[model samples]
Target: MKISNETIIEMYEKMVKIRKFETRAMNLFAEGQVGGFVHLYIGEEAVATGACESLRDDDYITSTHRGHGHILAKGGDMKYMMAELFGKETGYCKGKGGSMHIADATKGILGANGIVGAGHNIATGAGLGIQYKGTDQVCACFFGDASTNQSTFHEGLNLASTWKLPVVFICENNGYGISVSQARHQNITDISQRAVSYNIPGITVDGNDVFAVFEAVQEAVARARKGQGPTLIECKTYRWRGHFEGDPTVYRPEGELEQWKKKDPIPRVEKYILDNQVMTQAEMDKLNEKIDALVEEAVDFALASKFPDISSAVEDVYTDIVEEGRSR
Candidate 1:
């Protein structure tokens, strides 16, 4: 449980990067620079940072629609992500997959799914593959609380548990499925309790605390690497933004967001660093300035990049299209 100072600093940097990136993305969306539905991961930075920090570069992860944080935490390049947001050809998916569908197999990021609960089955499959190969690798599945209601959640968890697949299910209980609050959507308060049905270890942790999340996921990951099977970790967090950009969020009670804002994960980590003397105030300020400049550079790069040529639209779409055409 001894985390190195380097790792802690890295985690802090990633959290700051996510916050700055999402904030800039919000502004870009408001300015109409980004197209399509954009989900901002503003308040829940700690969960993704802590979880991904516990994983190796070769470890697999499946992302949700609100996935920029997950991708960035897993070492995704900001330039490519920003380019994809801008729909430029230099994007991760060559501009075809925008915010919701970016993927980097080299980094073990299967891709971010637009469909709710889609990552569950994908992570299970990846776990099964690792089991077949007899590797010590594990797959971490990230999803929202509402996704647990989907059939894929039950099916994936059940199969992974029964087969002892190496997968760690990370549920980010953000307290709402779009506008419907957690109380309205599910009867249970703690989503981790559902793991009993699958016969796997389940625990709930304060997602706002970076170290808490890191410790929980790190243990789960170690268990999986030992071929012990999967675990369910419920992160009780909150999203400061609406489900997506431009949502009025009328269903939320007055002052609810402000209350959650009081527990904002980025500031919590900043306070921890300062209190623990992990970094001097001057060092922290310099880190923040560097991250801000990096995010700004990403925006500039995306804007300067060219859009995909219309003629090349069908190029990467269908793998067998050329063969089929030749046969015809």
Candidate 2:
């Protein structure tokens, strides 16, 4: 599949945005400006950026805990995300849902899941809804390698396959399920192989290659839109940071992360752009400066935003039972 130069540049920009956002979030966490468990998607930017580029604005996506990258790629505003991290009322969830639970329904983001493999069922249900409505919409579900072990994964895949639901299961096999390495957690080398039982197309790709990921997902999205069953795409990538911020990552071998850094997706894309003469070095530099400023502005916006008022704690939480009874 031939991707246009414009699409490639956009994908590169999105990858850089994810890198910058996560880098800022990391520093903020260390400086005590942000709270809660923050999982950084430093090394896995390509997977999200490429996959999201293949999706339409009306298409749906379900993200995992390390979801900031996914949301941003799917057109999430950095200002609102930064506010949510700061627990400000101006956030997407009104300062209620933190790092792992941001959602933008208007943009087709079905919320990031805190529970492992929970997106499987949610994406399946969304696919079912699309099928019922007879729309060409498809839901792309993102999860980690270890999440495949969860019961929801099997159940969701089985049901979606049986019904030929328009869902795409994207497994980001980032080598570890939290602290446990892939070899330790699951015996299978390729998580995509799991799709065999469900009789769906299963593919494993180099997650670090943005174009490769884009092509694979574009094909899968097309298939889903055509009413075919879900496709399992295992992106074999690695996360530079620990499972969450402040995690020392003592479990990893000393040289493993350093080795993965050699294959950094951002640099790879940069090299492609320069080699192809797609953008001059000066243009790239200007783009970087612009992204840096945008991220800084988002930080400023979050800091200036107010926190959610304590009095309204139960406002969006429960139904107004008294009002409902009176009305009835």
Candidate 3:
């Protein structure tokens, strides 16, 4: 938990970036600039930011469907993210992967899977790779509470723990798995508490509190890289948006949404940074303006980028071409 003033400032900026990016992307989606399900990671910024602050440049991370926050926190580029959302050819996957399947290898972001809990196994496999290669790099897998019910969640954690793999299992219990409340989903109130069964240390943190999440992750990651074992960190947070872009969420309770809104990570981190003298308020304002302008430019770039030609629509099907060749 030895976080310096510099690290706090970076975390604050990253949380702000996530909120603004999600907000702008929602507006663009409404304007018809994007297609497919756009699940905004508006409320869960601090979870990704805080957890990933513990990772290094070479450390890998896998993301869930609602994963813009993880990608940004893991140092993903805004221009490519915007382009991918817009379905432009300049996207991370050259516009093939869309909103849910964004992957940036250069940043060590393995990918964001559309399927629930898919990234869990992928992250486990990555930890195995790290173990095999004898690298000190760690892997952080971001999954929602709904994903915990999925088989991969069990399989991945079991494998990671058995092998004592260097992986951080982050469960973002945002209180809902697309309209199903935590009360309805699991009997256990604290998802982190389940780590005891796996023989790994688990911690529950206020996901809205960026510093707390960051500190907890720092410890878990240090332990992981030391080859001790994986850690299960359940971040108690909320998603500001609906399950997807077009769902009018009549499912959520009235005051609960407003209650979580009071815990917005951006302002909380901003105030913490300023009040702690980590950075001046003027500097924070200037940084925000810079980030906003960068996002705006990314949007424009995405709009101006070329679309993938229809001729190659089926070109990326690897097995199809292999099967055709085998027929010869």
Q: Rate the local accuracy (lDDT) of all candidates.
A: 0.95, 0.94, 0.90
Give the clashing pairs for model 3.
Answer: none
Query: Between candidates 2 and 3, which one is better according to TM-score?
Result: 2
TM-score of 2: 0.97
Off by over 4 Å in 2: 319-328
Instruction: Output the worst ten-in-a-row residue range by lDDT, candidate 2.
Output: 319-328
**lDDT (Cα, 0-100) at 293 in candidate 3:** 97
On TM-score, the stronger of 1 and 3 is: 1
Clashes of each: 0, 0, 0
TM-score of each: 0.97, 0.97, 0.95
**What is the Cα root-mean-square deviation between model 3 and the actual structure?**
2.7
Ranking by lDDT: 1, 2, 3
> What are the per-residue Cα lDDT tens digits for candidate 2 across 59-157?
999999999999999999999999999999999988999999999999999999899999999999999999999999999999999999999999999
Per-residue error at 239 for model 3, in Å?
0.6
lDDT of 3 at 262: 95
